[model samples]
Target: MDFYLVFTIFIFAGALIGSGLSFYVEYTKLEALESYFSENKVVCDNKRFWGRNTHIDRFYRMLLISQLLAMPKTHIKRGDVTEAELAAIPLSLKRWALWPINFGFIWFASIIIWNVWYR
Candidate 1:
């Protein structure tokens, strides 16, 4: 295979692998969070449940602040879950889903530049 083609394929394959791994990590976290909420009987607003942060928040923060984030504002307002409740969450591995995506763009840009500069 041509060198450029080989490199492009490798880049795309890496992106695919990274994306798959990130998705699995995120799915696991979501399941864990949902179970935790159901057990604790915490109710979150629909907006909170479906927000951008809910979908794409980093895994490290997710592990730490998930309990706080899962709680509704009413609970906080009613003094059910305190700001100090926010302090006790454990630390864990950070899920990074964007590495492949960022690299994909870099690869694309490099390919374009290579073509232009070489031709």
Candidate 2:
């Protein structure tokens, strides 16, 4: 098999695994996260905009919360997240929620780079 083909397969597999992990997190941990940030306006707005108790909404909610947790300082400065709320989030939850999203982002960027380099 061609090296490019093998590389593409590897990337595709990683993306799939990341997506699966995201799905798992959405179903298993999203509700706990929602309760944790229930008082935050940004999270409330996201729930309202995305609607509640649906897969797509869950996915977006997970992404939003993950972003908020990832950059507490930025979100706090923007008044989207309070320091107390950010501090309340568990470190383990942060790791579980962040890894898949981060992986997906890096994989996507690498795919772009690969395409550019080969084309």
Candidate 3:
């Protein structure tokens, strides 16, 4: 019974994290949209969400920041992306939109395996 309880707890926590990530991705997309308008000077900065620093901003920025930090430091190339440009690809462009899907599967599989086999 206790093992089942623990398994359920883990699954619930994982699901919560996954849902939060989904929200973060949406927030990132909104921020990206804000940037696009800002570039054209069509939307004032005040109209953007929390001045583009919403609480969900960190992880979304992580994707861009990490990619920039991973690039080479040398040899100038005309088409090569600069650190700032690389750090601004917009989360809406990433294929990781389905990241939380894995969490749901893992949660279900954990419950099934633990309850049916371990318990």
Best-fitting candidate, scored by lDDT = 2
Model 2: residues >4 Å from true position, as ranges? none
- Model 3, 59-112: lDDT tens digits are 454333233334425311433344454345555443343454455567778768
Give the range where candidate 3 is weakest over 10 consecutive residues by summed lDDT.
40-49
Clashing residue pairs, backbone N/CA/C < 3 A, model 1: none
TM-score of each: 0.38, 0.90, 0.38
**Higher-lDDT candidate of 2 and 3:** 2
lDDT (Cα, tens digit) per residue for candidate 2, span 3-78? 8888888888988888888889999988888898988888899989998678888989888999998888998899
Model 1 global lDDT (CA atoms, 0 to 1): 0.50
Model 2 alpha-carbon miss at residue 72, Å: 1.2
Clashing pairs in 3: none
Report how far residue 49 has shifted in candidate 1, in Å.
4.3
